[model samples]
Target: MKTLLIWCLPALAWAQAPAANPPGPWSGGLGVGNGLEAHATRQTGGHLLLLGRARYAWWGPKSGPGSKLFDQLNTRSRQTELAVLAGRSLPVGRCRAYAAAGLAYLLGRQLGDYRYTTRSSGLLWGDATYYYAYRRYQALGLPLEIGFQGPLGRNQQRLGLALQANFNPERSAYCVLLTLNLSSWGNRIK
Candidate 1:
């Protein structure tokens, strides 16, 4: 049994290897739609990449019996995250597809109790028309993503579409991103 296991280990490792090792450099991508997404991908070896990503989202309150400055449907709660991810890409037809998972530091910020105040003394506080608040937050998150990539022009430029699911101790959501790569800055072997 031990000899059989030893023989299988090498086979398993070989099965996971890429058909070809394509050395790559650090490439940056910017994404839009369903929030903002940005990443820098640098190839460590073969199809492996180190991805640094950043994202931001918003959840706003509606008009609710108050006359605060934000009551005009022009305000939002801010949520932002930053992460370092590792991914692997494989060639599929004319494109390359990848999957990545990472931990993110998230910050959810917004006003808690909001109100409008009049300078007129103490006995004139009213209920149905004011806004006041403090900031709220959720600190940690995990993000999982899958994406497809295609070349754009030259210089290792590419375009990508990514789908992501973000999980936090307090909140969770899904987002889709359309990404544009500017250039590969890390690998000089173009």
Candidate 2:
């Protein structure tokens, strides 16, 4: 009985140790929508994401602007973006959330031609030329999210969703994202 008690005490101590919770290494997804801006112009674009992305964040924000004309000239611009994310485990009822903020760069372009009159000659000129330009802006914002993860078929996988709100010196945008995760790939020893 004394020998059995000594063996069981070590096992109980190992089981009572708190599990470690660390940030995930890599995650990516594909999504298509036009809720980033509040303009009539619909934007179609995809982003490639890298997790633990704190090193290269010094590049700031990415932005662009443009003008379109159909009898009347219309101009538009975008200034900021936010990324909110989370992870969870249902068996343990555990969850975590994180937010990131940065700057955005803006690009501008003209899509149509408009007539201009020469101030000195008083002569009307009908010439069409496209214009392109870029501008840089700063932004600081955050996003919040929740998620869950567990074991599946000898492999560990996680699923999560997030809503992000980004704000910059000029404007703000919102994004909704769905994430899928597969982990424990390289830790197996056969």
Candidate 3:
């Protein structure tokens, strides 16, 4: 029995040798989106969002901007964030639906104009000042995301879209993003 098993092991190893095609579980991509960020004080505004992302697998650990990274909504406001997440992915027809939750760091600032009239030399004149409606705050955040990606062609490239929400002690934000990824997910062997 040992001799027979040893003889079959060589054949099994040969059969399991590397194929012409390779599997690429790793993925990286870029994205663009729009965000609506609000403060606890009820100051809400829209921002143009930009992102960069990289990952290992849908159901495993990875790093990169899965949703958004930069927020330069207007001259009066700006924000930046980075996150680390744990997630799961599920098959949805030809697409994969994924969800992740993790910790993030948020840095944001906002400036507003404050104009008032003051009396000087018994005369009243208009005076202009600026105030931080939302003062610059850098704090920890909780980010949650849900999205899907699918093949773009016969190649490893894919197109994805996701909706993400960020919760922070100072503010919260919601974003919608579209991404393009290159992965070794579903490819034909030569």
For every candidate, C-alpha RMSD to the true structure in Å: 15.5, 18.3, 19.6
By lDDT, is 1 or 3 better?
Answer: 1
TM-score of 1: 0.64
lDDT of 1: 0.67
lDDT of candidates 1 onward, in order? 0.67, 0.33, 0.51
Once superposed on the true structure, which residue ranges of model 3 sit more than 4 Å away at CA?
A: 1-23, 35-74, 111-134, 184-190
- Over 1-190, each residue of candidate 3 has an lDDT whose tens digit, in order, gives 9999999987655433443454344445565666432111000122112222222111111222121233221224455667666666666665667777778787776343333323235346533222223467787888787777763333445567877777888657667777666544434322
What's the best-to-worst order under lDDT? 1, 3, 2
Where is model 2 more than 4 Å wrong at Cα? 1-136, 146-155, 185-190
Worst 10 residues of 2 by lDDT: 38-47
Runs in model 1 lying further than 4 Å from the true structure? 1-23, 61-74, 110-135, 187-190
Give all TM-scores, in the order shown. Answer: 0.64, 0.33, 0.55
Best candidate (score: TM-score):
1
| Model 1 Cα lDDT, one tens digit per residue, 122-151 | 567533334457467767778888888764
Which stretch of 10 consecutive residues in model 3 shows the poorest summed lDDT? 39-48
Better of 2 and 3 by TM-score: 3
